[model samples]
Target: MDTGFNWVKPMLLMIALAAIPSVSLGAGLPDRIALDSLKNLYDSVQFNHAGHIRLLKDCAGCHHHTTGNLVEDANCVRCHQNSSETKVVACRGCHAAQPFSAEAQRKKQAEMKLYHQDKPGLKGAYHLNCMGCHQKMGGPTGCKDCHPMNKTGEALYNTGSFAPKKTGKAAKEH
Candidate 1:
């Protein structure tokens, strides 16, 4: 019962190759943060690093092979990028209906607003973690990098069937 076209090896190899270059090339930002430091901070939910990197002349500085907004290694982002659901963490879930604001917070079914007081705000955490590093590395940053006022667009993920790995799970692709 062997088709013999196993694809796991190639998939793992590509992941490894992509991970090798995600280090801090020079632009300066640490690649990790504690979970307690990540609650309610990402309102729009796209993890603004990619947008921030676009403004920099050197892409590698923030986009090293093993860090910042890509699936690589043991980075905090690698697994959590999808949040609890299979959504893009925010890209498809929230849909921006309007920009995230504290006003929306007070009306957010109570549980959501007070849910993560122990965690640092996204902006605050990013600042405390990388502000100093960027200063040392001569990097550019400002309020806009973290909280741009206007944002739009769909993430446009390819439609595909996917599932978690577990023993004895059986299904068919239509």
Candidate 2:
């Protein structure tokens, strides 16, 4: 009767209890996330994931109904009133990088969900979600606020002498 498994039950119980608080307090969440899907013009955003979690104290604020939290937006509540948590909670999981691409457009058209017909692309989703909140909360709102533009972006936009010099037929076309 000298089995060594006597402590297993109590140890498991302690671990389970310890995990509950961490999950609720955002202890295991990533401290930062790189939002690089749309990094053509700007550098990948060093998203302060943990900071936002601490500030907002609610995953549903950004993850929406995917966090198993109640939907507050009238539009989202209409259909997702009883929406449960989903496995894929990341924005990129639902919003595509090239949402307007032919393949993406075809897939969107094929989907039966009429409610998500006009779902914005991943880039648009970030801008829409962050910009409005920032404006209201007195956070950074300029284009360079979150992700500063790279050298290529400056050149493309004709910022100073960084603009590529056009010659021959290219110049005439413009």
Candidate 3:
């Protein structure tokens, strides 16, 4: 029984284990997580973490490789092929909350790695990921759907008070 096929069994077992999604690992995670890394323009998102987990058993759907699931994104796999699960699974871990700030710029310049120089900031990451998935899933893609515009946002967009007032005819109709 000392044939070369002995190694094949262990290799197949490892492959099978890797194929299994990491949903079980998320059992202890909080069901609802408040995403407030970027809350200046809108209220914090009360993300139903557990609901998404149940809906999509694949942890890489949201957490990428942080949940120990191998990512299927070809671009990501190029450099992160061997990347293991990281302790921090939050988006803020990789995407800076204030990516355009002076401090963030300095940090980026200091890092020797140039591969991730164009990584989106926390806000951009949230919008891109959430909106893209929502579009395909037939979920809400409107700006106000997930993020209720706050007073600051209203003023910035010239909304609330800055909205055009009804003139003579329009006012009369109202």
Candidate 4:
């Protein structure tokens, strides 16, 4: 039987194999981002990319498909909670009072004068785990190594700033 389908099978296999390499395409990070000097980053936290991607199962899995943006949640619990209310608990509750804790900030500021003081703080572990893996994978090993603090990460999905702008009769106009 000289069926044309026999040749088609091999051709399709070849095409699929070629596509596999294309799937991993990455040119490089955007130019808008700057290198992580470490000095420029005191308050800015490190982001662990390798660790986060492992759990998410590629970018498409957890990110809202409709939006196609990386989430900008500073903490993990914020995204895990029901209906994305703000926190697994509360924003002000976890952060407490000011955007930065007033009391803690005061305490840290008080110790700013002391050399090598261990100020209290919490950071996303994804930063460590993911960055650790990237270095192991022979990727960049500094702050700029994985992220651009000044410019927004396109993959990171966020809502508040992206929300539709509402405009009409201002409260002042009334």
Candidate 5:
């Protein structure tokens, strides 16, 4: 009862099993991401996502609370919402710079006040996240470092010369 196809099946199975690891590896860090969700008062911050990935070495540096095993990168809007259970609410959705009416403005302010009791609005969150990290890491503390300004006091969208370098373990694994 010797079938010639017997060897073919096992060979195919081995190949399929070998390919599983590559398939399981998630997507690589993006080259760039525009942090313009709340860009009313200033120019949109152009983040070098891949460069940050290279520098940080772990996605958990920014995307916390995942126990260091990020199946997929969580969107900021997912958890940073009015209600819990991972609802997608944009930064400006709650932290509107200029609401339509006084009532709307008041409501937004109230929501922001309640949400960010200690800090404040979206600006506070940005400052806390960016400036806090910068200060801790000894990267840059100045406001102008993160948010570049022109001579006329306008916020310049400064995409600093950050070339993406390959991250160590994560990049190699992928």
Candidate 6:
């Protein structure tokens, strides 16, 4: 009745449990994301995270590091992992602020350009990721669509703007 097989069941069960991916890991998804880490030259991009989640199939659509399943917080070590603590890297941490001197600014710009040749600056990264996805999904692809200008022609924030534009024949019919 007991031929050392008792341990095998428990061992197999443990393995199976370990193999099962965590359904609820990492930080909970936010309804909205105000990207104001960097100084707001333009309006802090008001990201509708909840809406995006509904429209997209997977969390990985926005969180590139994620792989369909919910990502464990421990695994987010690629960007800002310290031995003592884990932290999200701020844009300014890498992308230095605009220099005051013209020559210094030019040099800094060149350096940033080279450093982010593949990765790109904060604005560039946002444009490539957000705008690219919007374009692919047949959404708005205009400056005013994301960053609406004020009556005086300055970028405005939280003014009930930044809605996706309706277009095409079907949109016209409506």
Best model per lDDT? 2
Model 1 gets an lDDT of 0.42
Runs in model 3 deviating more than 4 A are 1-28, 166-174
- The collision pairs in model 3 are none
Model 3 residue 3 CA deviation in Å:
54
What are the candidates' C-alpha RMSDs?
Answer: 21.0, 6.5, 10.3, 18.7, 14.6, 12.2
Candidate 5 residue lDDT tens string, 1-174 = 469677988999889778654323334334666876445534567877667666776654654433233434345335543323223223444444433558866765777745333334556655666787888888778756655543334423322333235545668888
- Displacement of residue 46 (Cα, Å) in model 4 is 15
Regarding TM-score, does 3 or 6 come out ahead?
Answer: 3
Model 6 misses residue 123 by how many Å? 0.7
Q: Give the TM-score of candidate 1.
A: 0.24
Off by over 4 Å in 1: 1-123, 151-174
TM-score of each: 0.24, 0.74, 0.73, 0.24, 0.43, 0.44
Model 4, runs deviating above 4 Å: 22-123, 133-139, 151-174
Positional deviation of 130 in candidate 4, in angstroms? 3.1
Cα deviation in Å at residue 43, candidate 3? 2.4
**Residue range with the least summed lDDT across 10 consecutive positions in model 4:** 87-96
Q: How far out, in Å, is residue 86 in model 4? A: 29
Candidate 4 structure, TM-score to reference: 0.24
Per-residue alpha-carbon lDDT of candidate 6 for residues 4-73, written as tens digits (9 for 90 to 100): 6889999998898676444323344456778653434344568776677667857655554434544445
Tens digits of per-residue lDDT, candidate 4, 1-174, equal 669568988999889778543433233312132213332333243443344444444552323221224455545335433333232321123322332477767866887875424421223223443466566777566754454433233223232344334434464476
lDDT of each: 0.42, 0.82, 0.81, 0.41, 0.54, 0.57
| Model 4 alpha-carbon miss at residue 2, Å | 8.4
- Candidate 3 achieves a global lDDT of 0.81
Give the Cα-based TM-score of candidate 6 against the true structure: 0.44
Order of candidate numbers by TM-score, starting with the best: 2, 3, 6, 5, 1, 4
Alpha-carbon deviation at 126 in model 4, angstroms: 2.1
